[model samples]
Structures are given as C-alpha cells and as structure tokens.
Target: MKILFVEDEATIAETTIPAFQKQGFPVDHVETVRDAEAALSVYDYDLILLDRVLPDGDGLDLLAALRRAKDATPVILMSSIRHSVAERISGLDRGADDYITKPFDRDELISRARSILRRPAAMSRRVIEIANVVMDIEARSLIVGGTAIRVARRELSLLEQLLGARGRIVPREAIERNCYGFDDEVSVNAIDVSLHRLRKALVDAGARIAIVTVRGIGYMVEETV
Candidate 1:
C-alpha cells in the first residue's frame, strides 16, 4: 500500500517511513498543510496518515478541505496534543476515518491502516466486478456464474492487486512486490509468465474481464465490452 504521511514531527516520520517501507508500503511525507494540499492534488495514496497539529495549519482544516472536495480516501489522524475523547470525536466528525494517539505502537497503527483499507468503501467497493468476473475478497477466491475458480497463490495475489487498485493501473513495481517475497528468486520474466497463465485460466473459466497490458508500463483489468 502507498501512503501520504502529513506530519511535522521529525522523530515520528523518520521512524515510520522505513518501518512501513520494510512491509512493502512506500510513504510520502509532507510536514506542512500546504505541502499536504499540494501532494493531494497530484498523487493518489491508498491511505493518508495525517498529524493533528502541523506547522502551517490545524490537521482538521485539511480534513475538512478533503471532505468538502468529496475526497473519501481513508484518513488516519495522529496527534499527541489532541488525543482526548472530544478531540478524536471532532476529528471523526470532520471526516477522519480513524484516529491514533501519538506514541502509538507502530504495529497497532499498521493494523488500523490495513483494517480501514480492507473494509468496503461506501463510495467505491472492496469486491471488484468487471464483466461477469467477481473477485470475492472476503473468501480470497474468484467466481464466475457462481462457480469457484482456482488460481495459484501468487497469481491470486496479482489478481487482488489489480482488482483492489482504486485506479486501474497496477505498476510493475507493485506487482513484483506483491507477487514475490524477499526470499523468492524472481526475474523480469516472472510477471510475464504469471500473467500469461492467469489470462488463460480466466479465459478458460469464461470470465469477460480483459487484462490489458499497457506495453512498457503495467497492466489494467477492464470489461471486455
């Protein structure tokens, strides 16, 4: 998962950046609300980790702006100064999905972030649908016409990565990270082989979702029609 961390605390950013990166999460950091706004305007982050207090403006302001713009991407607010019940409630009211008090356990923070991401979006969806193909995320399976389809573990991971993308584009880098672990000896041809097999499997199973290769960049899944 990719994240945008809007924090001014040097210590917290320094510690969490590498911690998250170690788990295949790349984090982009911004210390001020203006920079946060700029980042939001350009990039799409899976989750936003925002600080309650910033060098330029209150975190609440940024939250309010996002909501006003109808940006419903999940946001987790962190703060040492405003972790009280009322403060947290206020943040939630302003559109923060989850709030974490400062000095939190990194594991706990990661868990909360993943939990939010796992839940079906009220505005979008967790289970992806294209043509007749359904990705049943809860069961970690795929189905077409109510029949289950078996996919290899790594290939299933690849499918989930593509289907879970809010945007259709799934970068080659992300596919490599999600498909193979550190101990696995993976090569450039690994993705091509996996895609070829997966494409054939889905076709044989009668799915109408077309996995389109974007030439040099990545892949996207779309309805065949």
Candidate 2:
C-alpha cells in the first residue's frame, strides 16, 4: 500500500523509510507540514503516518485540515511526548484513527498500521504476514524478507490455504478442492508434489516461514521462529 510518512525528525525519518520499504510497503517521507499539504494534493495514499510535531505547524492541524476537506484517508498519529488518556481521546476526537507514543517497536508500529489498514472499509487486501514474509494475494507473489519471489499460480493458491489456517492442520481434501475444481483429474500424490515445489521456492527465497506435514493428517504453515 502507498503511505505518506510525515515526520520532521531527520533521524526518525531516515531510520523508518528503509524499514518500511523492505517489507514491500511503498513509503514517501516528508519533513514539514507545508510540504505535507502539498503532497496530499499530488498523491493518493492508503494511509498517513503523521508525526504530532512538525517544523512549520502541528501535525494535528494538517490532520484537521484533511478531515475538513472530507478526506477519508486513514491516519496513525505519532508523538515523541507522552500523551494522557484525555489527550489521546482528543486526538481521536479530532479524526485520527490510532495514536502511537514514541520509542515504539518498529514491528509493532507496522503491525498497528496494518491492523488499521485491514479494517473493512479502510484498505481492501487479501494478505497474510508470517515473520518478514508477506503473501500478497492480489499481486500473486510472495515477498520474503523484502524480496518479491515469483510464484506459480497453483503454488500461490496452495500457500494461501495453509497460511490462512494459522498453523492449524488443513485437510488434504480441502487443499485439493481449493487448488483444483471438482472436474479436474487428480493424481494420487499431486498435492505432495505441489507442496514440495512450494517448499523449495520458499527456501530459495529465504522466507522465515515453513509448511509442515501432520504425518497422519494434513499440513500446517508456521513462522520459522
């Protein structure tokens, strides 16, 4: 998804840009609120990561302006200073979707952003993240540790079923039904062959996830951690 990261702190912007880009999320960084306002006119973003403090004005002002213009872009507000419950409530009351205090975990920040984006009316995507690996169903590709790996169509379909189960055993019959229609002829070991190829591709791409067999049952996919 496209994201506008409006952060005035040089160090923070420098540190965050690459980290988000590494995960296949497109991030554009800007320092001042004036520049941020201009950017909003030029581009459309799935979300805005707005810092509370800005060089020219308060980030809240820009957020307020956006709301006044009837912009529906989701925003996650961030601040270096601690915010009291009332202050946080005030920010949300003003139109921000989520508030994040400084010195937060980068992963947690991304997780929160993803959670906000995953809301029904916000960002529409069918995606699953396990470790650093991101399965983009719409893209029909797997992003493993920031690198996009080309996947066969059939393999992509198979991976989705396993990942959606969240480590629970997904029956082979279920997988077959998903990968092939009812009329398609199936080999006795077709599923096994497809799983092997998918496994090999994940390894070659350095994904930190694995699909494991349940011996007497089906298969489960889990993060390598």
Candidate that would win on lDDT:
2
lDDT of 2 by residue, 31-84 (tens): 889988887887667789999988898899899999999998999999887478
Model 1 has a clash total of 0
List per-candidate RMSD values in Å. Answer: 6.2, 14.4
Local lDDT at 112 for model 1: 88
Q: Candidate 2 versus the native: TM-score? A: 0.58
**Per-residue lDDT value at 16 in model 2:** 78
- TM-score leader: 1
Q: How far is candidate 2 from the true structure (C-alpha RMSD, Å)?
A: 14.4
Q: In model 1, what is the error at residue 63, expressed in angstroms? A: 0.2
- The per-residue C-alpha lDDT of model 2 at residue 40 equals 83
